[model samples]
Target: MEVMEIIKDAFVFPSKDMKTLLIYVLLSLVAAGFSFFGTVVYVLGFVNPECFMWGGMAVIISLLIGWVMYGYLISVIKSGIEQSDEVPGFEWWENFITGFNNFIVTIVYFVIPAFITVIVGYMTNVYGNAMIVAQEIYLQATYSYMGSSSAIAFDAIYQALVNLLFSLTITITVAVVVFVIFSFLQTMAEARLANTGSLSEALNVFEAAKDIRRIGIGKVIILVLLVIIIVAVIEMIFSALFSIIPILSILSIIIAPYLAFFAQRAVGLLYSDIA
Candidate 1:
């Protein structure tokens, strides 16, 4: 199938069956609710420290929900590669373990860019700037929760790092480019893993690259570019739209997992030639 067709099909697939789409959206809402509960508890803990324990449990539950969602997405991709119209059903433990393995595979791919980001951060003292921003955010949160102003200690020192802003921007840009480049392999690896049901295939970069060769490098690159472009465009649109109608911003939350469905479907279709 052509890359454009694949993308179109992937984007439209989730909405092809309204019931399935609603189920996915309901799952997203459950995750969001638990996450919201955790946030509220953490903030309340600022007043009553005992609330922290419940906040921790809420966070754990939210993470578990996210993990299960990832497992189902793997199934979505599996269905896509098989060119099947059927929605894959959840297999509880199977989904959790597969999602965990996929998480490990993703972290493995992120190492190089993350290492470079760390090195650049250390050299430029960008981490100092990050710490300053974090402290400022914390102070604001404390003020909001406690109704008392908190000290902003590092603003003056942080301003000195304005000179490093260029270096920080370059670092982020380089990391994104490198990430996108590796994503081609990662996408291939993931599709193979989904197809073979083996974590080993996801780690086999050499084999993943071989699969890309079979799929055609030009086609793969275009697929990656298309996904990136669409994602960026939609992000911009949502940012602006949500800013205009802040209450409707909740729609973006619902849309997020559906976007994941679209991407994984494309990943499957992109590798469909070989799968």
Candidate 2:
């Protein structure tokens, strides 16, 4: 199928089996609630030490729930790709296992980029600290000298600022590249795992890269950008509509899983062509 057709199918895919879709939405909402609650608890713990224990536990539980939901969604996308007319139903154990496997795949694929990010972040931090210290020293000198060492202080401050800006620019650029590369591979990995139901197949980087090549990296980029744009537009529309009624706004939770399904369906269809 062409990209446009795939995009068209995604919007309608969920309605083909409303029952299955609703079940997914319900489960997804529960999972999202757990994740959100965990985040809130964790943040609160930082503000108040007494909440640490409960917050830690919530974080773990929420993470597990999220993993399982991710796995189930991948399975659904897999089913959609394999059999266009079929909608996969809830299978707790199976979905959890699949999601766990995918989680592992993600960690492994992410390690390199994560490491790079850490290094860049460390450098950024170092530059940032140096800048702070220089500013402090410059301030002290200005106060002590009453303009005698003003030029020196100004130069020091200027140098620190330049170094910090340079470090920050590099960090941001590298981070964006890493994110884009990993995101592309991650999608391919998910599709491979879902289609083959084999962890090994999903982790086969060489094969995945080849498939991506066949699909044309440029095309993949375009497809991803289009999907993002379409989803964002849908979200804006829903948010606007929901804003009218405070109570009805709660229904916004449904949009996450719904858009997730739509994007995955679009991806599945795109992968179907090359798979």
The residue-level lDDT of candidate 1 at 108 comes to: 85
Model 2: per-residue lDDT, tens digit, 46-162? 889867777777777777777778887897678657746676777878888898999988997898678888798797785565668677676967676784555666666777777
Q: For candidate 1, write residues 175-267 as lDDT tens digits.
A: 788777677878887898789999998889889889999999999888888988998899889999999999988887657767888888888
Q: List per-prediction Cα lDDT, in the order shown.
A: 0.81, 0.79
Model 1 TM-score? 0.74
Record all residue pairs in model 2 with backbone atoms less than 3 Å apart, i.e. clashing. Answer: none
Evaluated at residue 83, the lDDT of candidate 1 is 88
Q: Which stretches of candidate 1 lie over 4 Å from their true place?
A: 119-174, 234-254
Write out the backbone clash pairs for model 1: none
